[model samples]
Target: MSDRAVPATPPPLFDTAVVAGVGLIGGSVALGLRQRFLARRVVGLDASMDVLREAEALGVVDEVRISPGEWLREADLVVLAAPMRALEPLARELAPFLNPAALVTDVGSVKSGIAAEMERLGVRHFVPGHPMAGSERGGVVHARAALLENAVWVLTPTDHTPLTALSRARTLVEHLGAAPVVMPPAAHDDLVATISHLPYLASLALTHMVARDERLSLLAAGGFRDLTRVASGDPRMSRDMIVENKEALRCALERFRRQLERLEADLDEPEELLAAAYEGKRTRDSLPVVKRSLLPQKHDLVVAVPDRPNQIGAVTQALGAEGVNIKDIEVLAIREEGGALRLGLESPEEVQRAAGILTGAGFEVRGRS
Candidate 1:
């Protein structure tokens, strides 16, 4: 990204913006652009007429089309939200139609492959992006502007990419409520292999381990369910992501294997095993509440509430009533009877005010440890 600072009042980034493959990520981008009036017209392109109709019905886009045509020539911004395999082809097909000044980007998880393809194609304005925000559910029905809120959106710009184009892409990312992070495409792939791909495979492995025995499966509780949640995501999508970055993923798996071997060797040494567990806990505790750096810093308050109708809503309502805005939220634990929720606030002052509000409303509130 360029070093130029965005003015306090930046004009709309583009006159016409287009999003291809209007699925969860694509639809979310279209919605964000439309909601913020970042474009004069938001167009949705997909091979499925059904999807186009649904996006139109949901007001996710101002117009829908089956393919890129002459109108694409007017677009100042085009987001290729298609599958990883299809991105290169789609970019190639739309190249001749796009305005010379138009900025192009993608939401593909694996960046190195697409970055190389774009560089080879001489797509000067392209910026490869991966928004670290999504849900297990797929489709436009799950798309919403809030999905990208405070999320870290990574942009991988090749050496051929223009700085002005990168800056504009970053501006669009910020408008969608995401923090922009720039890094080499290879570095992005290597890092995500450890943080994302490996964890997903680990989730799958753990789920299979417990599921192999009916007795253990029947006893599975919240912790087991939470740990294996990613295994429940769309299997096809997971397969594609894992395979696309197999080289890095394999290296990550080898590192994990070594760690597991060390743990097994420490089984007979109780103190060593305990220390290993302690170190793991300390490292986990140091992760940011939200995955990025914030200026004022974010704080948290864990509120315990009964598992009743509207219980979660009541907690949020109480804080909202006190004008304490929530930055983010996560359910730490939930059982049939009750659960504890971790509410992220903007500052220590907001945390204090929120705690008082929830406690006044008859819910137990405590600061995050």
Candidate 2:
């Protein structure tokens, strides 16, 4: 079996889709569905009238509903894209309003608690999902049609879940240009605890520790800011995710603490610390890199460039001179020292050549292929 869910062209997967919250994630899902023509009519059901209006105005949804009862009955695919903590209560309120045949899923970060809540409420068609894509920003204004494109959209289903419901969820994921991976809810929570939740806590801890020191105000720069970017996301949502997966998070914290202790113990051993550092860089470099696509296909090449005039022009000129066509380019991030510039090429073949060209030009290239 393939490790990744195959992306298949989607037909009208559902007659209507009702996104529960029109925030960054929910709005993005609605936008993705509309872009793909996955739903004949897309509806927005959010508690915030302002958000619903904004989403509708942005064309993320075909129509806006003040209440779930207004559109819930007609919705064959319902996306609950609220925060983790609100899901249970939202489910309770939405349970009586759901169509018996409607396939319900969510875009929450943690799945175990949401899955348990779905089971507790006797929701047979519910699938728990966590899209491996987000930003420090929130709200409909920041939402994009390509937000979930080429990203991993994980769906966790129980053994009791009907295959049709599971398939429907997967098809929607594929329609959004995302790879769907199915797993048990508990496993999903455990994995994300280390990779997702723990990282947030670590960033927050770092920020908390460093920010209190007024002496480091001028000292902390590029590397420090880059490492702590996760701590800059919605604080309330981060806290909720951490608390919801505290059991798995506890285990992750213990492992992290042991690593920290080892580093402390090896403070005087320069070779040992250097070995640890190399191991980290090796592991990070081993992972597959997929960029959010602007065109139909994309291969991202991120270059670490100095913050000076003509640097971007020089990068583009190098590509032009090498006969490499640039499909798209973007400024991924900017630090106090330099900026990380991302370029999307047409094919994987262009990636290495571009990296080589930049490396030759004395640019620090991080090939994200």
Candidate 3:
């Protein structure tokens, strides 16, 4: 039940991974790669030496560097984990240092601008990746091993991108315990603008609207708290994301405004509007719950089980018998011969219960506190 007791195998892919920027996403990727892939060398680069040292001390990376230019040439894959505004400049700086065949990816929230810059720089091996995961928290200190597990990682590759490079990039993402979904550069931007960028703007605006009124702040409760939670994000990073994806975000905002106006106009017909809203909610809730990328909580666990018939059922049953409820479960690896199953349980107690059952049933289990 615990991450350490799981018998997950390393990914069969590249050995060396260099993360540029030891922030939340970057640090999480480094941790996932090192833990899941058993990467030969996981190196981290950051603008702040103190942050770099912290990342190394946290064991997210085997080593640390101050600049991407110093390590990019030798790394099999280079991941830019900085803010969107930094991606374009960093891409230009790293383009020359990158190995001709090495795969390059980024964790920037915005894709279109960075993708364009990569294309212009003739970075043939580039794959623009946006892991649709994160928390309001930022920085290396919040980096989590299961950050990308089961989360949708979108990659936008252009025609000029080499097939081999894209394949390797996908392998790297898989190794980091993420699900890679491919799309065109433009489409990726458009989709994220609607789902991601617009939401951030709305959250911030909602918070501002409440905070501006002294009396409203005092009356705010669970609904307002939950809705404005993401507004607590790092201002610099949020600003960068909004600016980098300005055009798409602007269009998304306009569409959202129109919807709001329609609802206001229908306020007189309360019952009809309520029914329409209820129908919309039903339709929205019908969609599959995509696993979101989130910082690992203190009591979380990642478990791995073999790819065998009835294995999942057996494991779930074993946990259920022990009264342990699984918070989340992901098939980290699935091969014809064997695979890895990662599970996130609610607490260490649940993990211990599940671990005892699975191990008693002859399954190898790893646990991470």
TM-score winner: 3
- Candidate 2, residue 328: the lDDT equals 84
Indicate the worst ten consecutive residues by lDDT in candidate 1: 3-12
lDDT of 1 by residue, 36-135 (tens): 5466689999999999999988888989999888889889899999877787788788877878788999999999888888777777899999999889
Model 3 root-mean-square deviation: 6.2
Writing each residue's lDDT as its tens digit, candidate 2 over 1-369 gives: 965322222235578888998899998898776654567778888888888878877777889987666458788889998777888888888888889899999999888888888888888999899998898899988887567878998999988788989998887787677889999998998899999889989988888888798787577789989989999989899999899899999999999899999998778898999998999899999987876555443476766666566677878988899999988887643434445566888788888889888887776554421
Give residue 213's error in model 3 in angstroms: 1.7
Local distance difference test values of all predictions, in order:
0.82, 0.80, 0.78
* C-alpha-based local distance difference test score of model 3: 0.78
Q: Report the C-alpha displacement of residue 312, candidate 2, in angstroms.
A: 34
What's the distance in Å from true for residue 93, model 1?
A: 2.3
Model 2 stretches astray by more than 4 angstroms: 1-11, 268-271, 294-369
CA deviation > 4 Å runs, candidate 1: 1-10, 291-369
Clash count for each candidate, listed in order shown: 0, 0, 13
Cα distance off (Å), candidate 3, residue 51:
1.1
RMSD of candidate 2 to true structure, Å: 13.4
Residue-level lDDT tens digits of model 3 in 141-242? 888877787888998888777788788778777767778999988888888889888999999888888778889988888788888777888888888888
